[model samples]
Target: MVLLTLWLTWAAASADTTKFDVQPFKINLGSEIPRLHALVNNTRLPSKALYGVGQDKGIELDFLAELRREWLEVFDWEAQEAELNRFTQYTAEIEGLTVHFVHEKSADPDAIPLILLHGWPGSFQEFAPIIKPLTTPTENVSFTVVVPSLPGFVFSSPPPRANWTVDDTARIFNVLMTEVLGYKTYALHGTDWGSVVGYSMYGSFNTTVRAAHFVFLPFFGPTPEEIAADNITLSDVEKVAENKGNLFVSLGLAYRDEQTQKPNDIGLALYDNPVGQLAWIGSKMKLWSDPRAGTPPSVLNTTAILTSVSLYALTSSFLTSVWIYASNPNGFSTTYSQAPTDAPMLFSQFEYNIIFYPEEYVKQTTKNLVSYKVHDFGGHFPGLDNPPALIEDIREIAAVFVR
Candidate 1:
């Protein structure tokens, strides 16, 4: 693994420039689209059903029907691309790979730098609302927020070779922050799969990252009590978190299993069938959403969820990311050998997301532990669901380290 990092086995990719660009930079609706109008009209979402009135109720029977109609009829790739391109985006080669990212900097030159990392089936679009507040804190946080489409996702190029892993990505990011932006230190935040990316940033180059925060705390080790007691303490908590992954043994590790094993097969499916893609991601968005919370605000809007995911999905990088998983099963697994001084780290255990009891995980890791706060609001995709609460927590925790 170290060798892969030392000598870039990864190949540098030149841009995949296409001459035929979509005018208006949006996907064009085909001539046949109007025919699907019947389905679109047939699928009407009733006002109050399934979780009701505007909150994330399970796509009302009517809405689902509409989703079917719209999806079958009006789902336009160009529209989403236009919306995506509206955000300032750029791609650059780093560490032998094409990396795509968005850098929304606060107008204030003095604002701190914060890197927001996204997870699997997710893209930087998740950070849209949260970015403004972070970039303008007080008034706003006033930080330059950089959201990157991890290598292999969307605009970014694929992993140079089969050996690239999270550590390499973190190293490349270190270059992005200090070398690219010239920030001696910056706060880092990530969710879901990105928890690993953000965490690895500290581990890969502890000296560079000032602080790191994660909405999803990923650890594949024993709990702290287990470590201290020197006995089997079990995970000690149950998160309703079930996915197509947990549906079966291999399924439980579906993301991991696929990433490690058959990433291409999964990616091919996501690309071939939009419905297949929706069911795969939509199911989880539904599961993570609290029926009590009404319609799980942050994670997705079933159809809109596809936007962020499809951004990555259409690129075919989803398969590459899966392969990364297949390659590095223990990518985020923290052990003694590759430990760093615990930088200030905060892990918000969304009431609904998995909580392996991070405080316990903290005790086991070898970092100069700072603080860890388990928040009550927002699970998995905190950026969209609970921006205000996330804003407050980030402000409080980030203040301690930024200074």
Candidate 2:
């Protein structure tokens, strides 16, 4: 009787861990490419700013014009789609929402399961470069990489109702990792809004989420009192990062505020306007990255930028994607929990990112911080800016599992 009870318990647990019904997906922009080009060709550019201070005013007229010309003349959506299809893509229904993701399983049977999360104005494309390397078995480690498109971004469906907070996203993704994919344990890495979701999982699903890594930490800004505390001495590098962060908060929060407060307004306005979508996301791609990040002289490669903008326009996800900010307006101000999470945490700080968290601030916010790294190059989108470094950092965090 005792043996039967134990067997039943084990059977139930195994049954609960069934693999998700994930269907193969491919990006086919057959007619959409020509349609996009037509819109780009028809777009009427505003006159060049009279007092042109360059990017300060917004995406430069000449820059937009050049990009428009490329979109209309040189950019090939079909080719780009084919390249994107190189990775195995799939969509699974989780809580009535269709979740789109790339699941690149490592050849090694013992590979670590790792989920990579991306933020707004970015998608699973952000992790394209690192996917192969992470999947390739190294002497020390190998990873089965899963990159999910946050709901309402690209292929993923929008929330069934409005006001889907980061916490909600975390819950759905937990289902994706554990229940659907049948991973008993996994690690997470994220940037921008992705970090918010990853943090949510780390805090809420401690039993399954063993470790997490982030390039961005939402709602973790240091208080004035903490900054002014006598024990903390600011290094020159730290001071520069702090000053840059302050400047960004003062000048760069307009987009965030608008997105959070009045998403429908902007979403409606830019819903059908492909050029408008381009300008909205393109400016950030140009400004937020390290100038020295990409293969092109400017950090924002024209082709890459266009690819991201096209995805938004093609899928009509701009409005719903921006709704994430509105859903969690108080997220940045609200503490995730009363105490720090027990799950091991790791953070990577880039110098030119919009916001910078000093080592002290990160240490204070994360209780079980196993690693904190500062890179000379790279920005908010470190995967695109410096993928090798990002991969290496992920490996460093993964080391904790073995230890």
Taken over the whole model, the C-alpha lDDT of each candidate is 0.59, 0.81
Per-residue C-alpha lDDT of model 2 across residues 1-403, encoded as one tens digit per residue: 8678556434422423224567889987677767777877788987666577778668887888888888888888888888789899889888889999998888766677899999988999878778999999888688888999999999999998887889899999998877777778789998889988887888788888888898888765554456778367766666666666776776788899999899999999999899999888888987888867566322347888888899999988999899998888876752534224577888888777878777776776667888988877777788878888888899876677631
Model 2 poorest ten-residue lDDT run: 9-18
Best by lDDT: 2
Query: What lDDT tens digits, residue by residue, belong to model 1 across residues 1-403?
Result: 6555323312111122332111122223334335433433443445546444431323335544555555655667567666656566666567667667776767655566788888766677777767777777575346777787777766666887877777778788787776655567788888877877787786777777777776664565344445457643333232232221133222234455665677677877655444455555555555454333334445445456656545544544556655657656776554533357456776555555533344555555545556566545455566666666677667655555653
The TM-scores, one per candidate, come to 0.73, 0.91
lDDT of residue 59 for candidate 2: 80
Best by TM-score: 2
TM-score of 1: 0.73
| Model 2: how far residue 261 lies from native, Å | 1.1
- Which segments of model 1 are wrong by more than 4 Å? 1-66, 73-83, 221-251, 292-299, 332-338
Q: After superposition, which runs of candidate 2 have C-alpha atoms over 4 Å from their true positions?
A: 1-20, 223-231, 234-236, 296-300, 334-340
